[model samples]
Target: MNIQCPNCQSIRITTKDEGKKVGGVIGAIGGGIHGISGALKGSQVGRAVGSIAGPAGGAVGSVAGAILGCLIGAISGGVAGAKLGEIVDQRILDNYLCQSCGHSFSIICHAGHSEPKIVGANFFNLTD
Candidate 1:
């Protein structure tokens, strides 16, 4: 979407994806922690399966399974987090950035009117 800077009327706008970045980090950490249980289960399964190949194979399989489990959990969590962060961005954060004037703001729509509201600044109607 093309967005113009409310302060300078510049069309160069950047999205500060703070929520997405932060959420992804937090989610990855949480997912990694949660995946520990899965990893242990996977380790047992892998050991059982690899027993046909003897001790060396079982050891390798256990490590591989644990790593795979953790990776899957982290990836899934990061994706979920990013999706949630997108919602947060749309709902709560002033996600728009103006490249020309360095003004950060969000567009607020009320009564069918779309107006730019600067973050951490006083509210005023742009139409006025």
Candidate 2:
């Protein structure tokens, strides 16, 4: 599933994809670092063993790593996403004048497949 900006009617990236993308990037980085460390220690396969060993160490470590990566990624993605949303929101407000007042107004952002709420009336005002 995906989320969309209410004001500009643009599709925004979803948390799920953001989290996974972040996790994958981090995991690869971690794995590379671990491998480097392993190579330094002469483990032959170095951190390359993580791919196979990750599961064998039980789901705990693997899950922990992924979750840790995800959390970091999600937070980072969320902040960036919010900023991007703001840009879109501003564009919408600047371009799409209010029907009633014919004045530019801020947008009210929403998530999921729900309908778009009016810019000024929603609980979470995207303008702020």
Candidate 3:
């Protein structure tokens, strides 16, 4: 669907996606914390697994496991955070920008209304 600016009827619009950004960051942080907890277990497991190779391998494995754990945690957390943030942007933030008018707005659904309406204005006073 083509969204036009309510004030100027311009098709050049940008979605703010503020919520998604925030959510993604938050989720990632939470996920990273979990990953850290997991990392300890991962390090133990890695050491045992790598020890089969040799003494040097065991030492390498422990470090590798910890790094892997941290990486996994950060990545998962970031993705989750971004997804949640997107939902917030759509549902709560004035997520649309009219390039022509520089007006920020959100598409809102009214109760018992069949169609969504373009609502709100200049929430961010943003310029590009």
TM-score, every prediction:
0.81, 0.30, 0.79
lDDT of each: 0.74, 0.43, 0.77
Q: List ranges where model 2 is wrong by over 4 Å.
A: 1-58, 94-128
- Summing lDDT over every window of 10 consecutive residues in candidate 2, give the lowest-scoring window: 12-21
lDDT tens digits by residue: candidate 1, 1-128: 55666677778889998899988988888888778877888888888888779998899889888888888888888888888887777667777788897777766543134544333233422332
Q: Specify the poorest-scoring 10-residue window by lDDT in model 1.
A: 119-128
Candidate 1 TM-score, true structure as reference? 0.81
lDDT of 2 by residue, 17-107 (tens): 3333444555555555544443344332323445566645444444445555545544554555555545554444332343333333333
User: What's the C-alpha lDDT at position 46 in model 1?
Assistant: 83
- Of the two candidates 1 and 3, the one with more favorable TM-score, higher being better, is 1
- What does candidate 3's lDDT look like per residue over 1-128, in tens digits? 55668777788998878888788878878988889977887788889999999998888888899888977998898998898887777777778888887877766544245654545434333432
Model 1: lDDT of residue 103: 78
Compute the lDDT for candidate 1.
0.74
- Check candidate 2 and list the clashing pairs: 35-47
Q: Which candidate is the best by TM-score?
A: 1
